[model samples]
Target: MSHEIRTPLTSVKGAIELLTDERYFKNNDQQSKLLTIAHANTERLLTLIGDILDFSKLDSGSLPMHFERQRIESVVTQAAQNLRTLIEERNIALEVLMANDLPDLMIDPNRIAQVVTNLISNALKFSPSNAQLRITVENWQGMVRVGVRDHGEGIAAENLPKLFKKFTQIDSTSTRRAGGTGLGLVICKGIVEQHGGQMSVESAPGEGSTFYFTLPAAPAGAPSTTAEASA
Candidate 1:
């Protein structure tokens, strides 16, 4: 199914690229508008396809985990920096607050960063320009909790139940504007669970939303499978 779908989608993407390129319909206003819609939807389709493929691998538990002792500040900072350009362009304030005594974690740095990035990205989608989105890391029980809070219109109670479900869209109009496959948070939840942690969300309409997840701290003398990979 993937192969069949990808074959046509690839052609559509290539065709849109040609039309939108400087060498082609760059002078045609109508074609330019059509090209914009075509290109955007094509990319959306590709994103959806990729999400499905990853979700399938997740279900099979075949996704590789290269856990290591990683520093929270470094991981969270990298994630924030990745979205810095978008945050600035949207005129939103992005803050990362890490507890000074936060512990090192036994986790896939890339995967954990992926979760942080996903949460922040979703927050950005709902956030009004000039609003604030903060990523907070702290000690939670025996684990480390990272939270992404966005001060926007906030989510409704009815949408809360569907927030982490695959392919679920909170609001059709909002989702269309946001331009995502809606699997970002679901993927984040799965990644956190793989690390023996939990992912949860708290929000109230007009009160904004906070998405958080916990990661177990690495025990003393914990070995790095990542290092083992090199050995």
Candidate 2:
């Protein structure tokens, strides 16, 4: 499937890149508009393909989890940094708040980062220009809790239950515009659960949503994974 789909798509993307070059094509409004549409659709197709592959691996429980004791804040912060360009483009004000002296979590940092990035990307997609989104991490009881809060047009009560279901996209104007395969949240939930954590959400119509996940803190006197330390 990868070879059949991605190979042609990659070739097409390369072709689009060449056509978009000013040296090849003269600057004309109609030409530029058509190329822009092609470019956007190409990128969207690639993203959907990626989501499908990820969902497949997750469903089969074949996706790797490299467990390590690490700071949750560090993982979340790095994920947010990777999306700096998107945040600027959307004009969204993003803030990360971490509680002092938080305990390290036993998790796969890359997987957790993927979850954080997915949640933040979803928030950014629904958020209007200049909106605010907060990512907070703190100790809850004996677990480390992290949340991505977004002030956007919120989901309905009925739909909140369906958000984590596979291929379940709510029928709303904002959702329609966001354009996702509906696998992101489900995949995120799978990853969190694999790390012995739980994921949930809180939202209402008109009020924004906050997606939360909690992982048990690493046991005291636990040593960091040697692979992680060396990396």
Candidate 3:
């Protein structure tokens, strides 16, 4: 994990060093583009590092849970907002559908948001530029299910079983094209399980894919609130 992180940090530092050189800035457009790519990759690397560290803490039973009532809609919205740039850049049609009667759930909002963001990012990575990605939230028999659906190149049947394995990618070509460190889904699964929830995926070749997870619902008949929380 440290090596994975340092790779991007080193690249970012190199980019910065180049930008500081007066001669390098002479080609403004090229330098700016290089810097942008380096900066974005650096951010992605940082996020991956955080997820790995969080997973480690959870595995060691050292991660603390902060449970509080939170609006599911808000958490979903936050995740969407974080990826708004990518969605817009790719011209992907993004939608969020929430049931009118959805109830507040107790969870670590930051961690849940991370799971949502990872799933959405994965969807975007596999999908075509103009494909549609939909996020749906609903109450299901005393549980809350959040679904991230993508009209993308679906995963092969043989690869489904290994989807959540750490450092596992669907295939080498896909991993190379998508530029992932292969720990995103693994971390997502860990986070969901830590919240007493279940994460899963459904897909078919030539069709779309939907990644869904179910979290325990707030206590029966508990009062609902719209306050935002981190997940």
Candidate 4:
């Protein structure tokens, strides 16, 4: 029911936001303000709805995945680059450190990218402006590992366990200010697990946080063929 309603709302919101552009409204300040508010709310609602749907699918073991042999560097780099504008706006220094000759992962590139994006987004949220965010990719214990490290107020020991829980926020005030439905990490963990990987985090109160996940590397000498899988 929610999705049914959200479909049309998304279309209407897109149209409304387009009209909110200065070139479209010329000197109509009042009209632009109204449209902008509507657009923002619409985006919020859409994000909430999408998160809820994704959570439901993940919990119900129905999320679709496409597994293929992909370079960890390419996927991680693409995911980080997609958020380049956001990082630049916050004056955050983004560094990507990839190990030499990392193994290819047998996973869903899009799903893995989504996981990377979510981790990076969370890191950016807690990190202060002008802080540094680092993404490191390397081969670990026969698996390919990707880690996102952020210089921010790190997660507490107790709250660390709750990081991947559904609808969980370590600090409500901080998470609310950062803007998320609290399902991002839950979904990310689910996606990684579905690909035979594990997600974990390391942090200290003031030392910052590093969220990492590992996926099984493609078998040695195996053919790089695409395959469809589902949770």
**Winner by TM-score:** 4
TM-score of 1: 0.82
Candidate 2 residue lDDT tens string, 1-231: 767978898899899989999987786899889989998899999989988987888887677777888989889999999999999998999889999979888888988999999999999998899999999999887889999999999988999889998999999999999898999999899888888889999999889999999899988887786333111
lDDT of 4 by residue, 1-231 (tens): 665868898899878877767676674778777777888888888877878888888998888888777788889889999999999999999999999978777888888888998899889889989999999988899888889999998878988989888887777565778877789899999998998899999999889999999989888876686657679
For model 4, the superposed segments whose C-alpha errors exceed 4 Å read 1-5
Candidate 2: stretches off by over 4 Å: 1-4, 23-26, 221-223, 226-231
Each model's backbone clash number: 0, 0, 7, 0
Please give me the total number of clashing residue pairs in predicted model 2: 0
Can you tell me which runs of candidate 1 are displaced by over 4 Å? 1-39, 226-231
Distance (Å) between predicted and true CA of 82, model 1?
1.5
Q: What is the lDDT of residue 151 in candidate 3?
A: 92
At residue 60, give the lDDT of candidate 2. Answer: 78
Error of 4 at 157 (Å): 0.2
For all candidates in order, the CA lDDT equals 0.83, 0.89, 0.80, 0.86
Model 3 lDDT per residue over 119-202, tens place:
998899888899899999998777899999999878778889898887777764545788765677877887788778999999
Question: What ranking of all candidate models by lDDT puts the best one first?
Answer: 2, 4, 1, 3
lDDT of 1 by residue, 1-231 (tens): 668978899999998898778965554788788889989888889877867766776777766678887787898899899889999999998777888998888888888888888888889988889999988999999889999999977888888989889888887455678877778878888889988899988999889999999988888888755532210
Lowest lDDT 10-mer window, candidate 4? 20-29
Error of 2 at 181 (Å): 1.1
